[model samples]
Target chain A: MEMTMCGIVGLFLKKEDLRPRLGDLLTDMLITMTDRGPDSAGIAIYGDEAPGLKMTIQSETPDETFAGLGDALTVAVGAPVPLRVADTHAVLILPEGTEAAARAFMTEKGIRVMGTGHAMEIFKEVGLPKDVAARFGVRGMGGSHGIGHTRMATESAVTTLGAHPFSTGDDQCLVHNGSLSNHNHLRRSLTQKGFPPSTENDTEVAACYISSRLAEGASLGEALEGTLDDLDGFFTFVVGTKTGFGVVRDPIACKPAVMAETDDYVAFGSEYRAFANLPGIEDARVWEPEPATVYFWER
Target chain B: MRTIDMATTPLRDLNSTLQAAAASGEGQWEIVNPKGSHAVAVGLDGPIAVTIKGSTGYYCAGMNKAAKIHVTGSVGPGVAENMMSGHVIIEGDASQYAGATGHGGLLVIKGNASSRCGISMKGIDIVVHGNIGHMSAFMAQSGNLVVLGDAGDALGDSLYEARLFVRGSVKSLGADCVEKEMRPEHVEILRDLLDRSGAEAKPEEFKRYGSARQLYNFHVDNAGAY
Candidate 1:
C-alpha cells in the first residue's frame, strides 16, 4: 500500500522551443500531485549538456561544505570543476573522464553524490512537494526531458535521500510508483552484478537493475521489458536515459498511469489530472498505456 | 440553462450544486473548463442533463441516478462507477473499468475502453464503439457488455449470468465463458442497444458469450477449476 500511492510525472519535449519550459511545466504537474505523496519529492532534469561530466551532490550543511570545495577538487583532479549550488544540492561540471576520481574524492570528503551525468541533475528533499520544488527552484530549470516523484514513504524513513528518482547509471535514472515485494532478493543479485543499491529504498534496487542491464548493452526498452519477467510486485517505472524517457508497468498494473502525446511533447502522469495545465493538452492524443508493454520516445 | 465554469468554482462546489439540483428537479447544465478534475458532477440524483466541455478525471458521474451526463472528451478511470441508474455518454475514449460495478444504467463510449471495462457490473448496459482491454467483465454477476471492437486477453473471467456480445474478434475467452448461440431475443436486444447507443454495426455481426454456470456454486469436486 505504501508503494502504490506515489505520484510519477514525466515530460519529454520534442520541440527545442519547449525545452526551456520543461521544469516549469513539470513543477506544476508535480505540485498538483501533492495529495498522492507528501513525505518526499524529487525531480531529475535532463538539461542542456556541455562537453563535461556534471555531478550533483548534496549536503546538510551547504555553505560550510561547498565553500572552497570546487577549487580543491579542481586541483586534486588536475582539471577545472565548476560548481553551481542550488540550496542543499550542488551541480559540479567536471572535465571529461574525471567522474570516477571526483566520486572517490567526494566520498572521502563525506559528501553524498546524488547523481552524475552529462545533463541530468537530481534535487530531492523531505517535505511537502510544493515546498521542495520551490526550495530547489525547480521551475526555473530547463531540460529536454525530466521525471519527478512525490513519495509517501511507506517502506523507508522520510529523509532527503529516501526519495524517488534514483540514479545509478551515467545519464540514466528511474522513478517508481509502486512497491517491490521481491526487492531484497533482487538487490542481492544486482549487487553481485556490480550495481549495488546505495539506499535501502526498494526503488533504488530497480534503478540499479536497469543501470546494470544498460551497462551490459541493453537498450532502455529492453531493460524495461526485463523488469516484467524478473521483478515481482506492482510498479509503474518511468526511466530516463541520455536522449529520451521510457515507461513500463507491471503486468497487474495496480498502479495507474496516463500518457499524452502531442507534436511538441510526450507527457506521463499518475493520473490525467496531473496534465490539466499543460499547453496544447486538449489537442494531445491521451490514452492509458497497456500493462507489460514498453513505450519509449527518443530524440 | 445554467453554465458553471470550473476554473472559478471549486470542484467540491461544482459537485454539490449538481447534486443539490436533484432537489430542485430536472434542469440543463453546462460545465466549462473541467480541465480533468476528479469526481466532477458525481452523486447527481435528478433528471438533469449535464454536458461537460472537456475531459474528466476519476469517477465522473459516479453513483449517478436519473441524470444524463455527456462529456465531449475522454474520461479517466472508474467513470460511472457504481452507478445506480442514469444515462452516461462519452464522446471519446474511456480509461480502465468504465461502468465498473454499476447496478443499473446505460453507458455508451464512442471510443475505446481500457482494461476491466464493466468489471463486476451488476445490471448496467455498456456499449463500447472500440476495443476493450484485458480481464474485462471479471467476476461480473449480471449485466450486458457489448463491444463493437476486439477484446483483449481473458475476456470475462469467472463470470456469472452477465451476457457478453462482441461484433469483432475476441482474443480469448476466460474460464467457463464460451461463445453461445445468438438467438433471436439476443439479436433484438443487441439491435436496440446498438441503436440507442448510436453504434453503426448490425446485430447479426455480433456473437454472444456468457457463463457456463459451472463456477456458480462451490462444490467439493470443483475447488481448483471453478
Candidate 2:
C-alpha cells in the first residue's frame, strides 16, 4: 500500500565537455533506483541533432517493421530518410522541414512515434532498468541532457507505451513519479484543445498540459509553475527540453525529490542514491526541492 | 565497532551481515559509504548501535526494535517506518512519511522533515529539530510529536489521543485537531522528550495540539464534519 510508484532522474551539464557522459551517468542513476520501480524503464536523451527532423519510434516487431523502412520513406518523401534501429526502437532522420510528411508516412505505415525533436531520442521497454538500458545501448550514447524513469505501473498497464518519458511535443518529454488524481478529467479537456495524449498514462496528460502551456509562449519555469495550480495530484515531474532541464513537485510534496548541483552539472533524482556515484557529488550542493516549486537549468 | 562497506557488499549481504552480527551479540556497527541504499539495518531487535556514515535511501531502519541507529547524512522516505522500539536519528533532512505507522520508539530528525511525518503513528515519540512539511501526524492514534520549528498545513488531521507540540506557527489543523492548554505536566513531558532527543529548544516555548474528541464515534451530528 505504501509503494512508491516510480523513480525519475534528470541531468543538465553546465560544462559542454560533460555532454558525452550524459547517457552513461543517467544510466547509472536510473539503474541505482531499481528498488523504487521494477516493472519497466525508459530514457529520453537530448543529443546533437542532425541536419533535419528526427523522430524516435518503437515497434513490438522491430525486424519486420524497420527493415528497408528508410529506403521506402526516402522514396515516398522524395528526400533522404535515414533510419537506425536499436532493439524495439528506431530513430528516423528526415530532410529539413519534412517532419509532417515523414510523420504522415509513418502513420500510413502504422508506426508509433515515441518522441519527435531535433535533439531528443526516446527509448523505452518493459523490463528492468539495466536490461532496458543495455538493450538500447543507452550507455554508449551521448547528449547534453536527459531524463529517465523506472515505473511500477499504478494507473495503467505495463506495456512499452505505458512507460514514463511520455512526449507530446517536439523536443519535449516528461517523467513522473506520482499519480494524478484528476487525469481523466484533464485528459478530456486536453484532447478537446488539440493536444490529445496518445497514451492512457497520467504522465502523458501532464506532458500535454506542459506542452500546451509552452505553445502559449510560457517559459519552462512558468509552465512548470502552472502545474502547481492546474494539476490536482501528488507528483514529482522531471522534464527535458531541447536546451533545458526542469523539475517540479505538487503542493503536498509527498513524493521524494532530491537535487544536487555542482559547477559542472545539475542532477536530480527521486532519492540521493541515484546520483551518489556521479563525479564531484561529494562536493556538490545537495538539497531537497521544496513543495510546489519549479527549478530549471539551461545551457 | 564493526565496519561494513556497502560499496563492496550488496544490500542483502550487508543486511544479513548486520543481522548475523546482532545475533552474535555485537553491540556496535559502523556502516561506511551507504551511498543512498534503501532498507539498511532494517528489522533489527537488540540493544545495538548502528552509525551510517553517508546518506541513505528509503526505509533505512524500518520495523526496528531496541536498536539505536544514527545517520550522518539525509535520509530518503519512510525512515524508521513501522518502528516498534529503540531510537533512530538523522543528522540531516528526512523525506516524506518519516516514521509512518510507527507503533513505538523514538525518531529524531535533526533537520527538516518533509510531509506526512509520523502519519498514522500508533505510539511513537517523534522529535524534529527543524520544520516539518504538510499533513504531519495525520490520523495519529497515540504518542507524542514535538516540533521545534514551524509545522505546515493540517498538522494533525483526524487525530486520536496523540499529543502534538509545535514551537512555531501551524498553517492549519485538520478535523478533530485542536490547540490544547499546556499544563505543567505537559511541559514536563515535553521537557523530558526534548532532553532525551538532545534538542536545544525549551519546552516552555511550545504550544500543545491534540484531538478535540468531536468525531471519535459514529454520531448523526458529525455527518457534516465527516
lDDT at A218, model 2: 95
lDDT, candidate 1, A1-299, per-residue tens = 24758899999999999988999999999998898999889999999896798899999999999999999998878899899999999999989878889988998999999998998999999999999999999999999999999988766678888887899988898999888889899989999999999777888999999999999999888999999999998899999999979999988776889999999999999988889999999999998898899999988
Steric clash pairs (candidate 2) = none
TM-score, predicted candidate 2 vs. hidden true structure: 0.90
Per-residue lDDT of model 1, residues B98-187, tens digit only:
999999989999989989999999999999999998889998888899999999889989999899999889988888888999999999
Chain B TM-scores, listed for every candidate in order, come to 0.96, 0.95
Residue-by-residue lDDT tens digits, candidate 2, A1-299 = 01266888888989888878889999999998787788899999999887787899988899999998888888888898888999999998888878888889879989899999999999999999999999999999898999999888754577888887899999999998887888889899999998998866677899999999999999999999999988887889899889989999988786889999999999999889998889998778777888888999877
Lowest lDDT 10-residue stretch of candidate 2 chain B: B17-26
For every candidate, give the share of true A-B contacts it also has: 0.80, 0.80
Estimate TM-scores for all models. Answer: 0.97, 0.90
Runs off by more than 4 Å, candidate 2: A1-4, A154-156, B10-13, B20-26, B217-226
After TM-score superposition, what is the CA distance of residue B63 in candidate 2 from its true location, in Å? Answer: 3.0
Model 1: TM-score for chain B: 0.96
lDDT of 1 at A255: 84
TM-score of chain A of 2: 0.97
